[model samples]
Target: MDFRLTDDQRALQAGMRTLLAARYPRERLRAAVDAPHGRSEVLGTQEGAGAPGVHGAAEPAVDRRLWAALGETGFFALRLPEEDGGAGLGLPEAVLLFEEAGRALLPGPLAATQLAAGLVPGAADGTRIVTALDGPGVTAHLASADAVLLLTGDTARLLPVEGGTGPRALAAAPFRSVDPLTPLHRVRELPSPARTAALGPAADAARLRREAALLTAAQQLGSARATLALAVSHARHRTQFGRPVGSFQAVQHLCAQMLVRTDLARAGVYAASLTEAPAEIMGAKLLADSAAIRNARDCLQVHGGLGFTWEADIHLHLKRAWVRACQWQSTEESEEFLANELLMDAAGENAPGVWWDTLGEENVQA
Candidate 1:
C-alpha cells in the first residue's frame, strides 16, 4: 500500500515544522540546557487564570512559553473531544506531531500532559504540566510538572504537586539528566495519589503503553532520520586522502545500512500506528529503538572525532534515544511478547509465521 501522507497531514507536518523551527530552535534548546534552572522561566501568565479549574503553576521543563505555543496550536488537546474543547483528532495526528517535536529536539513531559488532558485539573488547557511515573524508570522534567500521575496497571493516580496533595517526593529537586533537555529525578517511594481513575478494561494499560511507544517511536524515527542526514552531509563534505569520504565504499555501506534501518523503522511505526495491536506496537517499538540507536552510532562513526566531542549534538540524540528505548517497554519484553505472539499464531492459528496479519487486532482503545 502507498504510505503517502494526505494533503491535510502534509500541511499539519509543515505547520509543526515551521512553528518548532521558530520557537524551539537549536539555539533555544542549548540555552535551556545551559540555563541556571535547567530551563527558561515561565513564558507568561496562564491564559485563563483564576478560573474554576485553572492553576497557573504548570510550567514544563522547556520554556513554558513553548508549552504556551503548543497550547495555542491545540497541541495538548489533539486527542480530546471537540465538544469538550479539543481538536478532536486521533492517535495518527498525535504521532505525526511528536515526530516533528522529536526532529526539533523539543523537550518536556509531552506524553504525560497529552494523556492527562480532561482527566486532571488544568491539564487540557496547558495550565498544568503533567508528568507520570510508570515502572522503575527515572521520571523526566519532574520539577516542571505541577501534577504527577503514578501509572500502575489500568489505574492512574493523580498526585497534585501543591497543597501537599502530591506524594512524598524527595524534596522537589531536579536530577542531573543525561539528556540535558529532558531532566529527571529519582523517586524512592510514592505514598498515594490525590485522585484515581481506571484507565479502562481490556489491557488498557498495555494499549496506553503501546500509544506511548508509538509516539516515542516517532521520535526515534526523527532521530534516525536526522542522524542519517548528518552522516550523509559529513560524508559529502569531510575528506580523507584528498577525496570526500563519500567516495569510500566503507562509508557508503555504513550510510546505506543506516538508511535501511531508518526506512524499515518508519514503515513499522506507521503501520503500528494504524493497527495498535500490542504485537504490532511492540514490533514498531523494537524497530524504532534499533533504528534510532544504530543510526546515531553510525552517524557518530561517520562524524568520527567531532562526534565524540561534548560540543557535538550527535551524542545528545544517541543518549536520548538510548533513554527513550527503555521507557514504557523494553527491548527484551517486546521481543518476548512478539515471540509468544508468533508462537501462539504458529501453534493454534492457520500456520506458523502466517505473515503477522492473522495475529488479530487487540481492539485496544487508545
Candidate 2:
C-alpha cells in the first residue's frame, strides 16, 4: 500500500522538525544530561510557591514554562476539539508533533497532559487539571483527575497525592531505559479521597497508547539514525591496524544492519500511525522496540570501548530505549498480544497439513 504524506502533513512535519532542531539541539541535550537532577534545566522549578524537594532525587518538577510553550504552539491541544481551545487537528497531526518530541527527547508530563486535556473539564484551556495512569499497584482508576480515561480495564477511584505531584506508585519492574532525557517514575503509593468522574467509554486510552507507541518508534528511529551517524563518523576518524576502522568488513556489516533495522522500523511506525487498528499499533510497537534496542546496542558495538564510557552520548540512546521499550508495554507482552490477535484472525485453528506439504502440493506433478 502507498503510504504517502499529504502536503499539509509534510508541511507540519517539516515545521516540527525545524522547531525541535532549534530548541533541542545537542548542546541543550548535553546540558540537561550534566545537570545535578538529570532533568531539563528549563523545567527545574517546582509547582507550588513553597520550596520543592531535593532536585535530583524525586521526579523532576514539571517545566510549566515549557508546558505553556508547547500549549501555545498547539501541541498540547493537537487532537482536541476546536471548541475546546484546540486547533481541531486529528490523531495524524498529534502523531507528527509527538514524533518530533521523541526525536528531541523532550520530557515532562506530556503524554498525561495530552490525554487529560480534552477529557478533563477546562483542561483543554489549560486550567484546573489532574492526570494519572495505571501501573503496578494502581488499578485502572482516576482518583486524582478531574476526569479519567481508562485504556484497558474498568475505571475506579484512585487516592490523591498529599502535596505530591500526581498519582504515585511503584514500577512493576526495574527499567534502565535508554532515553534518560525522558525520565521514568515508579508508582509508590496510592492517594486518598479519590475524587473521580466518568468520561464514558472513550477511545482515549487506546489512542494514547497508539500515539505513544508510534511516536516512541519515531524517537527510536531518530536515535538509531543518530547513533549510526556517530558510529560512521567515529569509524572514519579512528584508525586501527594503520587503517580507518570503517575499512573493516565487520564494522561495515554492523552499520548496514543498523540502517536496515532503522528504515524498516520507521516504515512500520508510519504505517501504524496511519491506521486505527489495535493490532497494527501493537505490531508497530513491538517492531520499534526491537529496532531501537538492537540499533542502540549495535551503535555501541561500532564505537567499541569508547561507547561504554560515561562521556560518550551512546549511553543516552541506550537508556532511553530501555525505558521506552517497557513503557506503554514491554516488547514481550506486545508480541504476545499481536500473536494472539493473529491467531484469532486466522480462524483460531491450526494448519491441517505439514508446513512443507502445504507448499509442496501447490507445485505437485499436476
Go through the candidates in order and give each one's C-alpha lDDT: 0.73, 0.59
lDDT of 1 at 294: 94
TM-score of 2: 0.75
Q: Model 1 over residues 206-295: C-alpha lDDT tens digits?
A: 455667778888888888888998999999999989999989999999999999998999888888877776788889889999999999
Count residue pairs with overlapping backbones in model 2.
20
The CA lDDT at 313 in model 1 is: 75
Runs with alpha carbons beyond 4 Å of true place in candidate 2: 39-59, 121-131, 135-164, 167-183, 188-194, 201-207, 237-243, 348-366
lDDT of 2 by residue, 1-366 (tens): 666778998898888878767766778777777754453232222322122324433333344455555666676677777876788877666766666676666665455557666666544544433444544433111222333333443432322333433332312121222344443333454333234344555645555656656666666666666677787898899999999998999999998998888778777777777785666777777777777778779888988999998788888877877767776667887876666555445553343211222323332121
* Error in Å for residue 342 of model 2: 2.5
Collision pairs in model 1? none
Candidate 1: lDDT of 79?
85
Compute each candidate's TM-score over C-alphas: 0.82, 0.75
TM-score of 1: 0.82
Candidate 1 Cα RMSD (Å): 7.6
Clashes counted in candidate 1 amount to 0
The weakest ten consecutive residues by lDDT in model 1 span: 45-54
